[model samples]
Target: MDRLSRFARRIFALGAGSSMALVFLVIFVNSVRRYTIGKSIAWGEELPIYLTIYGVMFGIAYAYMTDSHIRFAVFLDMLEEKIKRFVLIACDLLTAATGVTLIFAGHAFAMRRGSVASSGLKSTGDWLAQITGIPWLEWVGKVGTWQYAIVLGGAMLAIAAILRLSERLSAPSKAKEPVAPLAAPAGKAST
Candidate 1:
């Protein structure tokens, strides 16, 4: 079980890291081309867009493992120990349900549209479509559309992590902010 968990974490980190790196590279290349060449690179925009989407989508699993997502820790920190556990369990269950629902929705939507025609992709190019050979990229052919589904799967896994870890955790410390707020004037009501 421990080995499996470690492997999963490694996979999550790799996916997120690759996606972010790709996104950055694409953007950087586009910027260089745009200014140096004095014209937009026709396909440059889509690479970053898709990479960002994939990176963000796949990063959830790792983020959950590290408990990095936004949380209501201010409130959780104030609760009694017993009450905190109850709230954490409730939160975990809610996350799991939410992840499952998203996966279902994504899959259903993908399947319904699978057979429908997709116009040629711009910017990033439908590399997925090209892989199997489709349109003009006869050499590449049509690509698989299963990747987005995988992203949804990762999110569900993240939720699973949350569920598994909830019972074992102490309430997390609140994150500190560098800039303290200035006090409002005594007579004026604060917004």
Candidate 2:
């Protein structure tokens, strides 16, 4: 399990890094073209927007895997150990539930958009279809942008939540160690 978690983290990091690099390169080239050639790539902005979506989706997973997501630690620190553990477990359960809800909602939204795109593609003239040589209806029918971003983010969050819950459950509880009394200083009378 530990090995699998490590491998997953590495894959997420690589994906996020690649997406970020692609976004940066696309924006840089587009800017150069606009300034030097006086014309920019038509689809340049679109590609970067998609890449940013992918990068942010993967980044969420990476943050969860690294335990870098923000939390109110001060409140947890003030709680008793057992109470803290209970609160953590509850939070993990809530996170998992939210992730599952997002996955379902994202899937539904993607399917609806795909259906709309497919219908629009089917209504286009043959000449346009022949010029593009794209199976637009079929392609749009199969994939949606939401699948790449929201669905992926939700799936990662769910996995992270489950892993956290398991780790918390398996960990051995630690008892507070007794503290020793401070001794009198050398050559000084005891209080």
Candidate 3:
């Protein structure tokens, strides 16, 4: 399980990095074309926006896996070990619940916009389908924005939250301290 989680984290990081790169390339090319050629790709703005949305969504999962997200540790740090463990468990439970909500909401949102075809992606999909000769590729070729935003992002977030909760629940508790024997008063030494 640990190995699987690590593998998943790596995959998420790769996806985020790839998306970020794509966005950067698209924006750079669009800028160059507009300035140098006095013309811009009609779909340039939309494509990079979508890629950025996907990148940020996947980045959230990567952050969670790496434990790099922001923490309000001022109060938590002051807690006793046992109490801190309990508090962490409670926080995990809350995060899990939020993930579940996102999953459901994202599904519904995706479904609602599933039939709406994106103008920017539709043409790109058609071109790819022609080159690849894959009929089913066109289906994803014309996906709605919600499919990228809610479906992919929300699903990844939910999965990350669940994995994090499981890790917290199964982690071993901190070892207890060894207590020293109490000494008798200096003037009165008993048997």
- Please report the candidate that would top TM-score against the real structure: 3
Point out where model 2 deviates above 4 Å.
Answer: 115-143, 182-191
lDDT of 2 at 161: 78
What tens digits encode model 3's per-residue C-alpha lDDT throughout 90-166? Answer: 77677666767777787787677766767767776677788899976665545554364666776777677777777
| Residues 1-191, model 2: lDDT tens digits | 66767777887788899999999998999999999999977657566776788788788777777777788989888998889889988988998888888789888878777444332223333335566886552442233742447888788878877777777788887556789999999999996
Lowest summed lDDT over 10 consecutive residues: which window, candidate 1?
138-147
Cα lDDT of model 1 by residue, 4-107, tens digit: 65666777788789989987887788899889988755546644665666677767777766567788899988997778777776776776777777777776
Best by lDDT: 3
What is model 2's C-alpha RMSD?
Answer: 4.7
In model 2, state the lDDT of residue 160: 75
TM-scores of all candidate predictions against the true structure: 0.64, 0.77, 0.78
Off by over 4 Å in 1: 38-41, 115-163, 166-191
Sorted by TM-score (best first), the order is: 3, 2, 1
True-structure lDDT of candidate 1: 0.62
Candidate 3: where is the Cα deviation over 4 Å?
Answer: 129-146, 175-191
TM-score for predicted model 2 compared with the true structure: 0.77
